[model samples]
Target: MSIKEKIMSDLKDAMKAKKTDELRVLRSLKAKILEKEISERKGGEASISDEQVIEVLMKAAKQRKESIDQFEQGGRDDLVDNEKQELAIIESYLPEMMDDDEIRSEVQKQIEQMGASSMADMGKVMGVMMSKLKGKAEGGDVSRIVKEELSK
Candidate 1:
């Protein structure tokens, strides 16, 4: 099933199981997806593609991560806990991200392929790496790895 369909199915299951936290997260996700669909609508019905859905999910997950960090920094343990729970739920729908080692290796490969030797080539390298990695890796991680590899 598509990611959107899976979310809908899981939303139903969460409702049936009386999972309050899961239900809240799923409902929020559904709302975000619907909002995205509406914004993209031009004339007829504009359904979001699986890739677009993933983009939405990734953005939501990123937001949750930022919230968790800010809450922790502000010493709001209760809010931090809540954000962590929400982050976990959001992450459940995302594809597995590349580990640091994998990201490092991929960055190295891309640098070699593009003959990127110095920091001046950072932008060119980043553009290719980001497009290649897409949803599989986070931009910050990829950029860090690329910088380390290029500086070597």
Candidate 2:
């Protein structure tokens, strides 16, 4: 099944199981997906693909992580715990992220493949790297590794 279908199926399961937290997150995700679909339709585009669903999921996860960090920094343990739970729910659908070592290796491979040398080629290297790494890794981590590799 597609990501959106899987999410919808899981939403029903969560509802049946009386999983309040999971249900809340799933509902929010569905709403976001619908919003994106409507926006795309306005732009004269067709329905969204699984890749677009993943993009929405990633954005939601990023927002939750930021909320968690801010709550922790402000000494709001109560809010932090809530945000962490939501973040966990949001991440359940995401692919596993690459570790630093894995990301660095991939960056190095791209740099060689693209024949990119020095900081001047950073943008070209980054474009290829991000498209390849997409949902498997965070952009910040990929960019950092690319910059470090290019500097070498």
Candidate 3:
């Protein structure tokens, strides 16, 4: 099944199981996907690609992570816990992220392939890496690794 279909199926299951937290997250995700579909509509039946669905999921996951961080910093343990639960639910649908070591190795390979020798080549390297990595890795992590490798 497509990611959107999987999410819809899981949403139904969550409802049947009386899983309030999961239901809430799934409902929110469905809304976001619908909104994306509407925005991309070109006059006929509106639909989104699986890649677009993943983009929406990634954005929602990032928002949850940011909320968790802010809530922890504010000493709001209850809110932090709630956000963490939501994050976990959202992440379950996302592709597995590359670990730091995997990301590091990929960055190194890209740097060498692009002949990126110093900080001056940082932008060129980042553009290539971000497109290559896309949803598999976060931008900040790739940037930091690229900077470290180029500075050496």
Candidate 4:
């Protein structure tokens, strides 16, 4: 099943199982997906694709992570715990992200493929790498690895 369909199915299951926290997260995700679909249609597009759904999920996950970070920095353990729970739920649907080693290796390969050397080519390397690693790796990690590799 598509990601959207899978989420919907899980939502129903969560509801049936009386998983209040999981149900709340699933409902919010469903609403976000529907909102994205409506916005796409209004833009003269047909509907949001699976890729778009992933994109939305990633954004939500990122937001939750940011909130967790800020909450922790502010010593708000209560809020941090809540954001962590939400982030865990959001991550249940995202594709497995590459670890640091994988990200570094991938960045090295891209740099070699592009024949990039020095910081001047950072833009060229980043543009292609971001598209190649989209949804699979975080942008910050990719950039850091690229910079480390190129500075060699």
lDDT of 2 by residue, 34-149 (tens): 99999889657668898889899999999998898899899999999999899888888887889999999888888888888899999998888889988989998898888889
* Local distance difference test scores for all models: 0.91, 0.91, 0.92, 0.90
Candidate 3 deviant stretches above 4 angstroms? none
What TM-score does candidate 1 get on C-alpha atoms? 0.95
Over 80-125, each residue of candidate 4 has an lDDT whose tens digit, in order, gives 9989999999998999999999988888888888889899999999
Best by TM-score: 3
Query: What would the per-residue lDDT of candidate 3 be over residues 1-152, giving only the tens digit for each residue?
Result: 99999999999999999999999999999999999999999988889988889889999988998998899899999999999999999999989999889988998998889888989999999999989888898888889988988989
Stretches of candidate 4 exceeding 4 Å from the true structure: 42-45
Q: Which ten residues in a row have the lowest lDDT in candidate 3?
A: 132-141
Clashing residue pair totals per candidate (backbone < 3 A): 0, 0, 0, 0
